[model samples]
Target: MVKFNVTRKETSPIDGQKPGTSGLRKKVKVFKQPNYLQNFVQSTFNALTPEKVKGATLVVSGDGRYYSKDAIQIIIKMAAANGVRRVWVGQHGLLSTPAVSAVIRERVGADGSKATGAFILTASHNPGGPHEDFGIKYNMENGGPAPEGITDKIFENTKTIKEYLVAEDLPDVDISTIGVTSFGGAEGQFDVDVFDSASDYVKLMKSIFDFESIKKLLSSPKFTFCYDALHGVAGAYAKRIFVEELGAPESSLLNCVPKEDFGGGHPDPNLTYAKELVARMGLGKTPSQDEPPEFGAAADGDADRNMVLGKRFFVTPSDSVAIIAANAVESIPYFSSGLKGVARFDIVLLRSMPTSAALDVVAKHLNLKFFEVPTGWKFFGNLMDAGLCSVCGEESFGTGSDHIREKDGIWAVLAWLSILAYKNKENLNGDQLVTVEDIVRKHWETYGRHYYTRYDYENVDAGAAKELMAHLVKLQSSIPDVNKLVKEIHSDVSNVASADEFEYKDPVDGSISKHQGIRYLFEDGSRLVS
Candidate 1:
């Protein structure tokens, strides 16, 4: 009999385990403590009402990072204990963030047992290893992360969870096998089905994209591209989509195998962490050993973030979203299939405040509806659900739309390919080529660029950070005034139109976060001090 051993409960050592901009993240050591994962999992189960838990269909998967497999097993046991009837887990515990979202939307419906939600094990672009960080996030029925209200309830329950229930003894089932594994004392009763992680997602992508056109672009003699998977979960998807489906040579992909620890490399697709891809794009020799490939791309762990580069040029995520929205009709088949004919509203776009204003120009030219929300994808969920927005993005290398609740890294890459195909169709070729860098330059030329940079101060004493923010707030409120010794310089030159700590209230639910971040907006185009 598989019985859960009772463990001593200590005062919750994780007071600040609240989810971050994406999800709850902390060092591996922190989550490895006995009953740490259990408390959180139980709290998650508690967040769901009895009706939401009993006989519910749940989706489960992870990024294949350190402790992912172990976490999946524990969650399976807990879900069964919580009276969940069926669970759709990724084969071998491998599913990218976007893939999980795709599964929830495709599998969860009225006819079948609606997918109550999902529990994804990932720390996103954060480093993964024995010593690095790990995380867990719960997505709601809408395939988006649990809103602030739900997360706060989970945190509150964690503080006092005395025990967690589980099946007495169940046979370990094969995760790769696509069949049911019985649980509980009754024979052939509660069960779980291990599903292929990439099948449904690939099918959806095929429906939305013109794979034949992309295949032609991939096979073109004039085009040469490289896709680096960073040894993350996307390796399988990339191999299937880029190699098997698109007919690209197997060698076109680098790091095309999933590893538990990402092979000692930080699986983040950025200039700092994805230096290998950057170096290859800048210096790798072509088939002639004299010229480099024309394009290169990379996706982060969980495959929800992408970085695009062309030869020696880098494309910012803000610019990427704008360009894709502008070319959506030509590149993506979903938008092109007369859907625009009915609505005719220029691609609706939304972005976080800190993101570059490049999209404003595209929105103005195309007469599209544009919105600026706080720095989190959850804020876009309301607009998308209300049918007011179709495309949205964040400056942190994230982009997605109503297609999926989370950012779709491979989708974005394919979107770029479609745009390239459209550019090739047009004969308006000039010195201003259709490269990743060209997209930014064109956007800047049209809409004066907003010089943007973020300074991240990590692990600062929480009290000190709070105090500093309070001082800034006081200064902003008392305009044109200063302390006895200190004089206010440039007061009139830079009028602080607004200065306050940021808070986000969920439109769907009235949950509120008092202090998300600090902001000081200036009248001049430039703003400072976060």
Candidate 2:
């Protein structure tokens, strides 16, 4: 072991250090500024209770984005100086956002210690490079993003931070290898444990899913599949799970190599960004020469968001969640028997407010508890922790369950595969297979379809965006005026029924979150939000 001493360095707060619900995101150049990352890291340490920091095991890793390697080393040294007991890192400093959450909640150290928290470093689905985006967020022990209370405190500390501690003599551990490197520090032994990136998460997934059934489905001659990691960290597990475990053909995987810059392509999983997968799935501008696979899926940079496709057909996130919930009892073994022993109304479903009412219809049909929260995973996280939610999703292609706090991209794919397997269990050897399109059509027929579409405008001038939002909110004050304007714009649209800024009051902690979004509801059940 190498001996090290903690050094307290003087510093000052930097502007724009506030973190959003996902975390602080900025260009790699901005994060590379001297003391910028340190200020935020220290502020986060200061925000936590002393016991949660001292002698606590923490996991630190993320999607293999540019500048992540350097950031990992800095955080390791700081963790040592801060008296953290151990830092668990995935091999090569790579771990999906959801994998980090699983590690926090499931991974046990060599000494039988479990992680208390994690610093998840990734800009989610954003592009990454030296000039592109980089990000950092903290997750708590429950494998969920920190609640607003902690994030608010972290923001407050960032504005007034005066100094930060670092173990300057601590050598950077070789994260490429799976082993533990220990350092003798003033506080005692500080260890950096580099482990395989996928084992713990795979174990968790195996526990929740019937891998044998999925393997049988993958082995079927009638079914063909494709998975694109989009060059994100999801690649780290795709081969291990899809090909090695579930027996998907190696040829079925696309862009499975982890690239720091995502191969110069946007890493979002939507049809707009997942061009390669879209083309292969025969949904792009150019049709595929070869027959498209029966099922295709893509994961975003951090592997928390998923876009699932069926040949040339697309499944909206709203329909995806509803379909999963409607069939979960028989499809996925984890959700068998109404999930966590809850029957009927005790089983919970959730969706973001912007999402269509597909899941609502399913919840009513299944007699399950349901909720519409704001467009943040934290809201879903709170409900999941309270055992009030089993499945939740957002219109932005994010989906997950109580299995993990973070939205799990690969898990969503596996869930789909599980459903496929359950549906075609008897048709595996037969030439006629139950196709994804067939299942989706059947779901729509049973639950009634809710057509949905979304448009996103990026890089708008902040002032103009704020003014537009203000105008929309002001328009909501007068439903009749809004209806008149709507009629003048489009005469066929229904009259406005009501409008308001969405608000949420947490059932568990009784915390209030206001102004989540602006909504305009029509008598025809159509809704618009900004």
Candidate 3:
């Protein structure tokens, strides 16, 4: 139709725009404004120097959500204008969060001969559609999401972006093809390559995990396992790895197909959204319930989140991390060579503050360093880079090591399989085996469960949420008066550890995040209000 070239102009909104925990996420309508996405994309391009853009190869992919394909076209044009030469896009614009990280690290590299990084368009587990939220995030050459320093620079550039350049209206290239196509006025220049999305990522997984061992485990007739992809991108990966590669029965996988709208359901792999899986595990053979049948594991949208269950048993993410850490050498090949040889006790195992103290026990037992950081996977990246830790996790269904930079749901599931296989090799019976639930139960029996329950007052007015947090903080400060009532319920309630609003300073850049959440810890091992 029509072709045009555009350039950035100094603009108010383009100056100093910040990205939150994931990216600049707001309501879907916020991104629908004319030239809204263009402005941000231009600002991002302007943030980088020509040296950073010229001849650089960038990996581009998204969660296969609505608006993702359109955004990819815009990015391709913008990249060409910014001097980017080659771009590697996932087939069908589908890439899990961890897969994006893997591609950036494995494909992108120095010398500019390979893809150097990527721009991931996803709001993560957040709902996605024309009417839902959309987002864009940049990953650095290391395959990790841009640290605060880089993101801040991008934001700074956004605030003062004068203009953004782009080809007027380049013909849309067929993303289904695994080849390069050029945009902009010049032919055979400004190329974007549609790469096999699952190829590079699957290779990375095979390298990190012991697929043979897991396959052996899956082959055993006595052992039974299930996997649910939650209608996210992992369906393909799961089917390939679990069914095709490992020969696990296809029936073992549920919802093992990706859907643009996640089959009209929330794709979060938490107790709330994955109720079907939980219910199946809880009620064996009860056809009365309309719940989907039980599965051993469930993955969330984008396949970065996971929930593990075993018939009537649930595993908290805290216990999962601790268990994996405690058994890493035996279960995961990456660590089997003896972590002591590669890293020192500086190996800090970290977890979110709200997570149970189970990892603390593991760290103490193993004599490894441990840290309790604010909730958010980003907090662990610094410790991992410092060699101060090898692994970290959060109470939310997130777990990962220094392997890539994000929580890998499938990786965690494979870890469980490896652990189970090792136990089976030791002649442990299914009943005698230490499932995630058993580990958590034992942890609680020793440390006592926190009786934790998170109240997420969703959609509450921002002002009201703040007021509620303030009230909680004030109540924590006046705990002495409330101690009498608290003691009546639990007489052994000991000294209340200092209570205050939780704040975090990024260990890498020292950017402070205030009021991450509120926390109350008691000497008796009970915690409240996070």
Candidate 4:
């Protein structure tokens, strides 16, 4: 018989558990310390308040990376001891970041229950294994990351947390199968439900996109497509949506199996890390011989980040969101009501010194309202929650819309596919299909192109990185001198109109965030900065 008595284990507070922009990510060994994961989880529960967590349905899942299975069992036991009514988990503890958000928003239980919050286990694009990175972040009922207030409260709770409650003796529930595991607990009956990870997200994608149109494009011999999941949980959804639902050939999918260590390769979907994808797209150092696929894409470890390619060309993340926004009303069925919904979904945008001004150009041309915010995707979520922006993205391969609270990797891929299909609908079987490069080139010719590039000297001397950041700050006082030097260097370069540190005040929450980054604005809508 399973012992379900709650255990009140006294424990000392642990230090350095604060969450960053994404979540509380640390080395796996750092997370393996006694009472580390428990204290943080309990602190998050406390931050949500005892009433909210008690008798509430919570979702727990991740990318099936190392230690995620064990973490899920531990969290399940803790939830039972804390009087949680029911916990929903993906099969085998596998769920992408966006899928977790989809479950919170749409998944319904056997008795019409909906998830109130979630503990998303992932280190995002970071490498994962027993010796690699792992992380956990809490999401609210709104299907968004816990707002800054909640995260701050959780951090504060962690500092003074005296004890954690857990049903330590509860037998580990089997998560490999889709079924409900029941246990009699002191508070009441507790349940753990393991469900298919891809169903809810696949439903959401189907609702938003026209799968028939995409299938037509995929079946066309002229329009070859490839998708690399980087061995993350995305493979579950990609196989379900891309191959099963959309009728793409299984051979077109690569690395579509989840691995504990991401097949010993960095799972980030960038030109630097997604080597197999780059090679298949004919962009690697040793390029492929066969003609590259007409379209190719890759997703990060958790599948909330994406990199899109056209043969050897790459589509910048910022442009991907803007292109999606521009074509959504026509290509995607969900936006068919002309984006003038209960709340008008207009514009694609981001803030100061954008990596690419292409989205700003689209917003300006469409007469959509634009905004500048601090350097964090959460701020974009805030803006979207207020109905201020419809689509947003970062230069670092993240893109999404107000459709879901989080950046979605698969959604971006679908958007690109929709654009491709729409552009060549009449010519699906023709010898020539409009390609990704053509779509991007056409967008540039019409909207005006802005050269975009980013340089990151990462994993460098920590002290030197700090010194470099400080130097950039110090240069603010000499803006005029910098402009003069720029003028001396090249007449084609624009003069610096202003230089300052970026700060933001959230109109929705009245919260202040400062020093997002330094920007050097030019006289002709150009920017050069750190």
For TM-score, the strongest prediction is 2
Q: Write candidate 3's Cα lDDT for 1-530 as tens digits.
A: 23335454334563224787676776567766666777787766666666668878888887776778888988888787677877788888888888888887776433346666788888777776667767788876767777666677778866766667776566676897877675554423577788777877778878878788778777765666778777888886888788887889998888877777777777888777776666666633444353332228988777878887765777778778887888787677888664766464656788888887778888888778777777666677766666666777877788888888778898888888887777666544344444555555765676445444555566779898778777778887677865766788888778676677888776756778777778777777667855
Per-residue lDDT tens digits for candidate 2, residues 1-530, read: 79999999999989998889799999999999999999999999999999889999999999989999999999999999999999999999999999998898888887999999999999999999988999999999899998999999999999999999999988889999999998998779988999999999999999989999999999988799999999999999999999999999999999999999999999999889999888988998988998989999999999999999998999888888888888888888887765555465678899999999999999998778889998878899998888899999999999999998999999999999999999999889987888889999999899899999999998889999999999999888888899999999989999999999999998888999999999999999989988
Tens-digit lDDT track for model 4 on 1-530? 24489999998889998988777998899889999999999999888876668889999999888989989999999999889999999999999998998899898999998999999999999999989999999988867788788899999999999999999889999999999989888778899999998899999998889999999999887888899999998898988999999899999999989999999888999889888888988998995998999999999999999999998999887778777767777888777774665334354356433446777778788777777765556788787777676777777788887777888999999999998999999998787889899988888888877777887675699899889788878877897888778879997898888888877888888998877788888998877667
What's the TM-score of each model vs. the native? 0.89, 0.99, 0.89, 0.95
How does model 2 score by TM-score?
0.99
Per-residue lDDT of model 1, residues 1-530, tens digit only: 23332223344434766676676888888888877887888888888887677888888888899988878887887777777877788899889999988888886433366677899999988779889989999988888877666887887887767777665344455777765665553322466778788898999999888998878777777777889989888897998999999988897898869887888898888777786777777843322333546678898888999988887777878788887887788678888763456474845788877777777777888777787777767778776767777888877888887888888899999998887766665432333336656655766787666666655675699999879878877776654453221325543455655666777665544556566556666666555546
Q: Which TM-score value belongs to model 3?
A: 0.89
User: Candidate 3 regions off by >4 Å?
Assistant: 1-17, 108-112, 183-188, 283-295, 340-346, 426-451, 475-479, 482-495, 505-512
Off by more than 4 A, model 1: 1-14, 108-111, 185-188, 283-290, 337-342, 426-433, 458-464, 479-497, 503-513
lDDT of each: 0.76, 0.92, 0.74, 0.86
Candidate ranking under lDDT, highest first, comes to 2, 4, 1, 3
> Candidate 3: deviation at residue 48, Å?
3.4
